[model samples]
Target: MSNNHLTREELQDYVQHVFGASYLITQSARIHGGAQKVIYKIDCTNGFTCMLYVWDISSNYFQEEILNEPTFHSSYGSELFSLNTRFLAQHGIRTPILYDLNNDRDRHSYDFALVEYVDGQKAEAYFQHKNHKDRDELFQRIRDMLSNMHGIQRNVYGNANDNSKKAGPCYQVQRLDAETALSYASKHMKDIRKNDKRLLEKLCELEAAIQPRDLYNFIHGELGPDHIWIDHAMQPCLIDIEGAGFFDLEHEHSFLEFRFGDFYHYLKNNDLDPERMTFYRFCHHLSLISGGLKLLHRQFPDQQFARGLAEYHARCVVQMLS
Candidate 1:
């Protein structure tokens, strides 16, 4: 029983209660990835397998006020683990099937989400073993999946949150245009790096040059190798749908470019504006730097690795601006 959250006994009891009295716990293993959440794979005596995601609400990364919101407990909270999964699944995207969600903080300080266990290697590892032709096919499939999600249009632009009985797009922060988004990023950078006026000015110049586009589409906020999983059949399935929402299509494309440099030329030739992509890339870099610094300040103030990441992302932002 680790002190991080629920004890092994408590978890087993919850699983048994959810699965039924006939089901017995067979195995449990911790799966690692994101820093803010803890995931466990649980197998039952009846041969049923499921994933349990425990959110660490005590972490400094989470906003307590947001978590405390009534809607947060509804479609917007741990339910998002299920909501987003179903939303993507409807678009022909492969994602885990959510079984249940428990947000009884009084019973357990952390929130828990039970989902189907996916069997496959992460896309990052799978790609290392593939040939060029195979990798190209996989990339195409990924693009197709992105296009499918983007095809689901909404009139509003913002984060996808629980609206009434269903998940809908809602702007928690207004970013109606390129300039407004850039201004938000600039202010964030200034707040995190108070003494770095030179970098702020450079960011401002980049912001000034951006031409706002009114295009809005559903975007996977964090699309990288880590979140993509490839099954035995070489089919790609996207996971970690937590940060997904309606935003500029260019933002998603730019992130795809930043993470995989090979995509830059392909995107540029396919009608994606070079300057818009660059501006979004800069915004992504700023976000990475800001997030890294926050992690360093709150969770790992004494860890050299956290400090190194913060420095690396800051350097990337500076280089992008230059």
Candidate 2:
């Protein structure tokens, strides 16, 4: 997740390779974080300035992205480019204006995608700066934007109630009943917390029902400080679009709780039905905890903090409501 180095010649070759040599005038700057690719700032002589993200990638990941791009896009896929596009537009999101792809060109090497650089500083940098006193205000702004996004009327995937798509619905999740989901995971998975199983039992007793196309429809899928930018006027914009697919809106509701260190205000902001929202929140937390356990079961898995604490927090929420 750190910058991998390439010589100026290599950069030039890459630019030329992606854009063709004659018209490609450029300077290179690096973007850093949990990002998997090399992001460079490229300036062309035609007054065209764009951002290039290259993945010196593994073939498996490369192929997956190429094949999955359409599915991602289809879940508000139209928002892939064009400034201020809807579906995921209007909510202060800024994503690379994807232009071209060099997908799966080389099997052993890497793949690259070209996009217009989002113009802004990382939102977290501004908010977390030692001297910045506006941290609370920035948080509120982000909260407002997310609340607005959740205001969308459509589901993330084409089918809001269909579970077959994996990333659809207000409660898609393959339309599994609580028992089946838990049984499948417990028998087939590992690295799970004991608390998750307990939480699921409580949730299943309540039998929360999901509604499609409700006011709280859209979900960010992933929401944390790492995936955003702030424009010149200090507007918040989301940069990472990889996890911007569909899911239960409860994901977004639980998202604020998961990252913001609190859940009360998030519930308040949406004018949420206290009883129903609380139930869904429990479901979301339990699901994430379950997911983390399954990931841990994988031979080589990425153990993330969010995933690790999911079960613990789910229990806390369950107790609060109970």
The model with the greatest lDDT is 1
Deviation in Å, model 2, residue 95 alpha carbon: 2.1
For candidate 1, write residues 169-234 as lDDT tens digits: 222121122233333335545533553555556555655566655456887777877777887787
The residue-by-residue lDDT of candidate 2 on 185-247, one tens digit each, is 455334223444564556654444543453335555556555667766666777655445444
TM-score of 1: 0.77
What is the alpha-carbon RMSD of candidate 1 to the true structure? Answer: 5.3
Going through the candidates in order, what is the number of backbone clashes in each?
0, 2
TM-scores vs. true structure, each candidate: 0.77, 0.59
Clashing pairs in 2: 73-77, 160-169
For all the candidates, what are their Cα RMSDs to the real structure? Answer: 5.3, 6.7
Candidate 2 lDDT trough over 10 residues, lowest sum: 72-81
